[model samples]
Target: MNIFKRTGKMALGSRLRMLTAKFTDDASSIYNLYNIDMQPKWFPVFYVLSERDDVTITEIAVEIGHSQPSVSKIVREMAAKGLVIEKKDAADGRRNVVQLSAAGKAIIVKIQDQYQDVNDAVEELSAEANHDLWKAIEEWEFLLEQKSLFQRVRERRKQRESGFVEIVPYEAKYQSAFRELNVEWISTYFKMEEADYKSLDHADSYILDRGGHILVALYRGEPVGVCALIKMDDPDCDFELAKMAVSPKAQGQNIGWLLGNAAIEKARSLGAKSLYLESNTILKPAISLYHKLGFKKVTGRPTPYERANFQMELKLG
Candidate 1:
């Protein structure tokens, strides 16, 4: 039976429960396929509770964003399984505090080791697949959070007619507009210097000389956004994607994502094995886009580059 069909009336909480049920099944099936006994859900809850054994049931529910009754039931089940024990709060007799039993702790340790085996099997399948799966899950979480904010914005805004937006490769005629958009976006968000902004045009020329491409987003013949793909000079390095900028006035319309997708496609066409980008935390929207695009965070930072304030990379097929 469809879990959502049964719980469709309860709104967000029910939807969350449905999602949990779906993924819980997936995890259990994956473990069974590998002849493993444990699934993934218990660890997160166990780890959280184990850290603060005296934490109240209400606190656990809040920390995990589950209903109080739901958490209570789960804790009761865990207690029955000898995985957790609930005791009266020392300070508040009416309140119950949860702690992991020794058996529970042992199970978590074994699960942690088994998780490495699962990760290894996943990595062997394809790095890109693993990255894409993780990204899709994260995007689902983000959209759920944004639903309320989107509804609030819709309540106050007039519905405008949709208009066409064109995307074109960067050219001399659109150079000034392209530069202006980059300058405005970087300056406002990153506080980058004028010289650093000016250097981007030069860097574009350098990239073009090495078989890389740059693209611009146009709105009715006016350039409003930009992104670029540059083949790496070092044989050891993969193609570098850079200079992604969307006009502040043109944001919230999904233009940045469109530009990014174009860049990734272009890189793939160029026979690149990996695509990398440089960005900063100040540009939160851009960072979010990178994450949505399946780019994972890495430890290293970018070298000195005209458009870069930091760096992230994604492996491609």
Candidate 2:
């Protein structure tokens, strides 16, 4: 019924639950269509167990981003189904380790093609949305471990209710703020490449003088986020969305979204035809934001940074 289209963010939890149920039911149907004899919910734990010879329940929980108790329950079901074997860890008798059984291995081997087909289908579905749901879900799970959903909600509510976030243009004194903000996100997900250092350390020489623009988000008059629209010398007068970050303290404040919208407007004001960005799939939130701003995936050219695997661009005019 397109619950997402109907409810939007007003009923996020309910919409997500409906979508999850739909996906799970569709996956089960696909397995049955392929003559596979496993439920869709078992794929995550089974896939993790298949990758390693032996792993503890806690380890599986960490790897699959599931709660220990939830993983243990799945393990018990799989063990009874003869799909997995659980044994006491030799080093820690209190800990129980698990592994895929011979039967499970045989079944997986038989359904390998089906797995590929499912993944390919998922990719096609993701293309329709212009973003990968699997990647988004995984990254969200990673973030939930770092900060709970309730905590993020409280922080966002406080920020919105207080109206402390303000978007402003880059100033000379904000050079250090720019560098620090960019470094925080890069160091968290990737190392700062030489290109990053060159541009960030000298914004005037590498960006401003080259007809680029930078925007900073201030929280209570302190620079808390930054994003840049870097001008390119190509015939199209392109702008690369680059060096964007928000301070951890100012996260959940919609600063990134504010900075991104500002950059897009700046690019248009500069007569840029399109905007490009390079990023890793692990940075799912960032990629999702780009998609939300009308960016679409494109084949990336050779990149100077090691972490860039996904490339996307937005048309301005």
Candidate 3:
């Protein structure tokens, strides 16, 4: 039984690695046949050097699609074998550049016939397989760069998990969840202050009964995210969009985003003119999310929370 064959696409990386091992072994034998003194892994660096002179590791990395550290390590290995030389860039005293040594140039000259033979062999192999592998690889890389595999999987995962998310108005049964969710996030980032406990402890009184609203997000009928449109006593803003929290497990599913937009619409329904929020600068993603929701930074207002160094307001018409 072949596990890779059975697993199919799930084993794509393993299958590619297996093929690489076979190809590398064949490359080693081919080098031996031509009396070459270089390893297959070092060929990329040597090929770049053969075409150019006085290049930095950054240039080599960009040319070959490899990382700077990997290129530097390969350069060091080649230097140890006396096949390459490293020199300080005359134009830039602080930086170093690499070029092929005399022996390296000799190796390229020796491999000219070998390169021709290898090219012919590859052409024949591609013809026999009826597949242009080089072109296919380029197309595959372009598509992956446009949208990474992680992003693709994340979208699919969200689609699958969203079936479990539900948004509902506040209920007495959800009091503990309302407090716990806020406490979990606040304790993780900053200290729990008097304002947090005041609203979280008795949300119905501190927020709801005072002409405010609360929205609860239920994942599989359990509270996973919650936010409040706390009515304000001030004249400028009608509501404070605060106490927004999402469970760690429910993150990446846009649960927080859904709740935020819901709260905004809910505030509008209640005839709100503007919305205000206070958050810490350390919560960069939260700040970014607020900005995306049309919230702009505001100043000159005193905050009640100890962690409120950043404030934003959104106008609702």
Candidate 4:
């Protein structure tokens, strides 16, 4: 039974493993034809050693994109087979370096024809298909580096969960909730300064009454997140996106993202041209979210809070 055929893309890792196993099996047979005693799995490390001399296992692992332990095991096996020599590193006594032995160098000369034949075969195989699997794999690796499959799936999940959340305008009943949420979040990461108290203690008088807006996220009819668009007097920006916080119990459901988007739209609806924010660099996830929301760092703006180390601004039409 072909489990991958039934599982489809969900079995991608398994399918790749199966294909690699087949390739490795064929490669071992090919090595036997050349009278070479080597495992197919050691080919990457062996080839790396053939090109370089006196390389550490960590260097080889990085070069071949394998783990240090895996590379170390292969180096030991090669040393056992008399194909490579291992010695303590002169610069670092704790580490060992490896290089091709005389036998290993001779094997490289003997396999020059085999390497050429393999390359030609790979080219021919790629040409036989309309879509080149080799090129596709390279492009896939590049894309995965930019945004992995895990992140892509997580985004989809966030999108699904965000639909269940409702962004509502500020209400009198949620006044304390807004204050508590922000206070809890801030106190968890930093001390609550006077500037924070001035806003949280009287959000309505300081924010809502002064041509600003506040957004609250409701999950199951309960407030789980909040963000404020405080009207700014700066010449460069119209509003400051401040006091964003999400409840720990309702975290990971994209509540912060939803509230942030809602707050931006609220500001834009109020004829805002740009938005600014103040935050510390220690809040990496929040900084990343701000970047994702199209915010860019800017200097020369003096901060009111001692904890704020960076300021970001988002230009809006």
Name the best candidate (by TM-score). Answer: 3
Clashing residue pairs, backbone N/CA/C < 3 A, model 1: none
Error of 1 at 62 (Å): 13
TM-score, model 4 to reference: 0.75
lDDT of each: 0.71, 0.86, 0.92, 0.90
lDDT tens readout by residue for model 1, 192-218: 665455447675556666677889877
Compare candidates 1 and 4 on lDDT and give the better one.
Answer: 4
Residue 211 deviation, candidate 3, in Å? 2.5
Off by over 4 Å in 4: 29-35, 51-59, 87-97, 109-131, 193-198, 219-222, 231-238, 249-254, 273-276, 291-317
Residue 190 alpha-carbon offset, candidate 2, angstroms: 1.6
Candidate 3 regions exceeding 4 Å error are 1-5, 88-95, 233-236, 268-273
* Better candidate number, 2 or 4, judged by lDDT: 4
Q: How far is candidate 1 from the true structure (C-alpha RMSD, Å)?
A: 16.0
Q: Which window of ten consecutive residues has the lowest lDDT sum in model 4?
A: 1-10
Query: Using lDDT as the measure, what is the rank order of every candidate, best first?
Result: 3, 4, 2, 1
Candidate 1 accuracy as lDDT? 0.71
Q: What TM-score does model 2 achieve against the real structure?
A: 0.52
Q: What's the TM-score of every candidate structure?
A: 0.48, 0.52, 0.86, 0.75
Can you write out model 4's per-residue Cα lDDT over 101-182, one digit (the tens) per residue? 9999999989988889889988998889789898899999999999999999888888888888999999999999999999
- Over 4 Å off in model 1, which ranges? 1-163, 193-198, 305-309
What TM-score does structure 3 among the candidates reach?
Answer: 0.86
RMSD of each: 16.0, 15.5, 2.8, 4.2
